[model samples]
Target: MATRPTMPAAAATTSPDDLLRLDRQVCFALAVAARNVIALYRPVLEPLGLTHPQYLVMLALWERSPLTVREIGQLISLEPATLSPLLKRLESAGLVTRDRHPEDDRALAITLTERGRLLREQALQVPPRIVATLGMDVEELQALHASLSRVIAASTPAHQPRR
Candidate 1:
């Protein structure tokens, strides 16, 4: 059986200064982990012609097509300013279409094109490839996901003014 790698021990004596240490910062660790994991997706997504953010937008659209820009932003936790350029690029790639909503002149509705729909089949391979690259078991990944979800929930402010 393979042994799991262990983290280095923390200082035996806890000092107030320990709280300020770089290694002890959760935000730093989370940011590093996010960057590293996203880096792992870069090569895999390249063949599909997507950047990490574009891949996320595609994932949202795959789950539910014809979503409004606002809806996609809400689902992906991105601002419209950030998502608009992505949608425009996807539209240019012939993967998606942006149309003015029938009922709301101000709203833009995003829909997957035929190419986008077909890309889903290729995307089906991405998760398994990522799992293999991570070298983690499904159960372990699930537990980590649960813990991260808890952290996100705890860190999010209780009151958010609706946009």
Candidate 2:
């Protein structure tokens, strides 16, 4: 078997390296965007007494009450291992409760508390502020969102359980 010849580092840079170029790598951009976006959310969420992850959990419960922990985990694209601590914190904060499911003895149901419901009213301001902080117009933001959604759909592992 013949070994392929290696290009010198200088030679590799002479050509337009599609691999290194920003536009060509969706994951690279997405990772950076996710980090920056989360950073933006941090300050916005502080006053609400929620972390970004907790805020997401609240959003899910606010939209639909009485989701099981497993159900919330699936809807939020989180594994039970990752969600357990967050739910524990939320429960401790008096925002949510975990109770045994009536029909399914094995699963635990998660319900938002009155405090959590009231928190939703305060949360209404968060999204608009996030959008404004992005400093991108609606069209740019929409296009970015749609493109990222497509990438997520294509790249996420298959056979994940649905809520």
In model 1, where is the ten-residue run with the lowest total lDDT? 5-14
Q: In every candidate, how many clashes are there?
A: 0, 0
- TM-score of every candidate: 0.88, 0.83
Clashing pairs in 2: none
Lowest lDDT sum, 10 consecutive residues, model 2, at 154-163
User: Best candidate per lDDT, number?
Assistant: 1
- Give per-residue CA lDDT, model 2, range 1-163, as digits (tens): 9999998686576666755777657677778879999999999999989999999999999999899988898788898889989999999999999999998999989999999999999999998999899888988889988987777777677834465
Candidate 1 residue-wise lDDT, 129-158, digit = tens: 999999999999999999998888777677
Model 1, residue 93: distance off in Å is 0.4
Q: Stretches of candidate 2 above 4 Å error?
A: 1-17, 21-24, 159-163
Off by over 4 Å in 1: 1-13, 159-163
| Global lDDT scores for all candidate models | 0.94, 0.89
